[model samples]
Target chain A: MIESVHEVLTRSALVSVAATLVAAVIGIGLGTALALARIPGKQLMTAVVNTGMAVPTVVIGLAVALLLWRSGPLGHLDLMYTVHGMVLAQVLIATPLITGITLAAMRLLPSALPDQLRALGANRAQLVLRMWIEARIPLLAAAMAGFGKAISEVGAVTIVGGNIHGHTQVMTTAIVERVGRGDFNSALLYGAVLLALAFAVNGLLASVRHRGASWERN
Target chain B: MGAELSLRQVRQVRAGREVLRIDALDIGPGEHMSVLGPNGAGKTTLLRLLVGVDRPTSGTVTLDGVSTARRGVEVRRRVAYATQQPGLLSTSVRRNVELPLRWRKVPRRERARLVAEALDRLRVAHLADRPAQTLSGGEQQRVNLARALAIDPEVLLLDEPAAGLDAQTRSAFFADLEQALADRATTVVQVSHRAEEALRFADRVVVLVEGSVHQVGAPEALHHRPADASVAALVGYDNLVSATVRTDGEVLVGGAPTGLLHRGPAGAATVAVFAGGVLLADAHGPGLPVRVARVIPGPGHHVLALEGAVSLLAHLPMRVQAPLTGDVVRVVFDPVLSVVLPDSPADPTPGVLDGVELAYPSRVPS
Candidate 1:
């Protein structure tokens, strides 16, 4: 039972971390572009992103499930009921949240900072990079938020990964499966492990944020 | 080498309202030009265009004949701008000063030298290790200027660098700033609304009003011979009173001779009177009779607010007896301290005062 719990915890950590990393890359990039560029339909895009942030995990799971089903358009990839499919579903659920936070973080910086950076001879890339570093605390919070949403969500992984033991089951799906089988003790153990895993990851990230914040002050 | 900046037919429109329009302006290499204007006069808009942070709605702002809007980072690398706000990054003052050098790809050793030199020049070297965000406004501004100067930019643009500081701090900031740039031949352009700030340390001053360049000349030229009544008010001619210039060239205020003359075909004119030139005497002389309304003490003088057919202000030396409020006195305008500008119908008489009752008898000078 402990071995099974370890396997499920490891899978959960791997899949969630993978999804968070992918979501962060896409979210930060998109958010920065939206924040700085003078593109049209920006208001509409922001509205869509805001709606996506508040949309339910179950709704996103349903969408990903429909797209990756055997008869669906992406069926040729054969990702349905796989760990990759689970990661994809979690990414969908977390990307919008990370993106929204990032957009707000970038906007909170001094409006003239980008121009000041340009005036200081920073090229386009340097401007964005420096601004990100300036707002790194909020950005790190965005990443943590994304990871929290990714690892803790149960509906998306349940629907898309299908909880196949020794194959696609994560801690969330494992707890759900144990409870279904009336194995109350095993369910409580998986739940305890999930809570510990979240606390450990967030604690590590918070320390890194603290160091980044105090790097120059000291 | 310093870069020559020019604006040709430049116009800036924001929210469909024209904010700045300049037909032609040129700052020569190594020249220290100051753009002087009142608040909302688009001085900052002009600086933003020159710094390439903003593009003009029409025409061009060019550095060495290269349009700033189209110029690449190579061109931008030669210019630096110190904004009105001390926009410091959340870092050490040393890093804030060093980042520009880093951006310009200065060698590590050279970057260190420039950073230290700039910090020392701005008198902020002692604050190097301090977090920039924790400094006071004046110190942060010094750091901001230090960062801009660290790159040894050929063209430095300062937008009211000492704007919000107190009088003493502003004076010290400018003194340090002047000492810092005394040896460098950078083409610098500073913008400020205060007359003293615009005139100080500037080889040439541009008088901007309502998005238009009213006058551009040497600081002394703008101070002594402002082109219009509005320009006069901007350049520290505190009292703008309605006057008439006779065909014989004698200037008259309130149907009385003012002992000043102008070489213009003038029927009506506005007399720009310096506050120090409005001499006061007991109401027995051949001058305009006025009632003292307020006698405000100053550092070494007394400012008397006087009411007559027109409101006027007179600066008297502290040794002289200043009249109390409601004391009638005769005020005379010294010709050397006054200029007769052609009638600017749009400007109200006495540019700085309001609410004082002015009831002149219908007495026309013959």
Candidate 2:
């Protein structure tokens, strides 16, 4: 029992950590691009991103499953019912949340920054890098929000991972399985561990974001 | 070295409206030029075009006679534009000043030297290690100016660089800024709606109204011989009264002849007078009848409003006991100082008074 629970905890951490890393990278990049690019259909893209933020995670899971199912266009990859499939589904569920927060943070910046940087002779790459640096603290906050969504998400991961014992079982799926049987205590332990992990990650992020960010210390 | 900047028949259109139309404008090599105008008068737009950030809707803008249309981003390297808001990074002041140097990929040693010089020049060297976000608005603006100068730009455009500073701070900043650029061979194009700053700092001034150049000349010419009511108000004319030019070429106020003479064809003309041009006249003497309605005190002067056919605001040199309120006194303008221009047709759009009220009060803290 202890060994299985340990596997569940490790698998859950792996899935959330991998998904958060991938989503954060893509989301921050895409969000910054959206904020800075003045191309056509920018408003339309922003509207679509906002709508994507409201998409249900289960719907994402179903969509991904369909795409990766046998005879589906992406079926050649055979990501279904595998850990890779869970990561893919989790990424889809978390990217929008991460992206929405990052976009909002970048948008809140004073509009003159990009222009001023250009005046100072910054090339395109320099402008983007400077903007990212100025938005560092808030982007970290975006990461925290993304992690929260990725770790707590159940619908997408369960639908894709299949909750198979000793294989795809993560903490949340194990807890669900335990509840379906007569193992409430085990279910409670998994719940407690998930909560603790979330607190740990968020606390670390908060310290970096807010501590000594006062005027004097920058 | 210094670059000559000019606009040849340039026009800017926005939302299908021609917002700026300039036939010809020249900023001589190493000259300081200021453009004064009301809000939404396209002052910022003109600067943007000069810096080559935006192409003109028509015609050409040139730097040193080379057209800016095809200069590309490379043109931006030779010029620096700073807006009213001192947009500084959230990093150290030294870093903010080091930005231009960094973008040019200057060697680390040279970058440090240039950054230090810029900081010292702007008089913000003491705050070099402090976070730029922590500095006061004036300090941040100084750093912004320092960053602009770090590139040794040939043409510099500043939009209200000294804006939001107190009188003392503004003067001090300008003194430092001018000294910094005095030997740099840089041609500066600045936009300042403040009459005194433009008059004091710029060798040439352009007054813009409704996206068209109203008048361009020495600051004194714009101040003393404004082209019309709009230009008059922009040049700090406290009183603009429309009057008829009599057959004898004498302008009349309140249907009676005043001593002010005009050289234009006899018809309608608008009289423009500054506060210092108003002189106290004998009640029964050659001036018009007026009652002092209020006296507002300034640092070295007093503003007195007179009620006549139209209310007039005038600046009087500081006196121990100027005329009191409710005193009916005859006041006459210094004919040599006043201006008479052909009365322009009443504008279909909003008047310049509304523009003045809209621009100043919101910016200046009462």
* Candidate 2 per-residue lDDT over residues B1-366, each given as its tens digit: 878988989999999999999999988989988999888999999988887767999999998888765684677788988888988888789888887777787899999998898888998999999988889989988998998898788989999899999999999988998899888778888898888877777889998888999888898777656777888888887788877777766677787544566656677777777776666654565666778999989778888999987678777767535789999876666664577776644321111110112111222122
Per-residue lDDT of model 1, residues B16-61, tens digit only: 9999999999999999999999999999999989988889999999
* Tens digit of per-residue lDDT, candidate 1, span A63-112: 99999999999988999999999999999988999999999999999998
Tell me how far the alpha carbon of residue B90 in candidate 1 is from the true structure, in angstroms, after superposition.
0.7
After the best TM-score superposition of candidate 2, give how far the Cα of residue B229 lies from its true spot, in angstroms: 2.4
lDDT of 2 at B147: 88
Q: Mind sharing the TM-score for model 1? A: 0.95
Q: For model 2, what is the C-alpha lDDT against the true structure?
A: 0.80
| Residue B348 displacement in candidate 2 (angstroms) | 24
| Candidate 2 backbone collisions, by pair | none
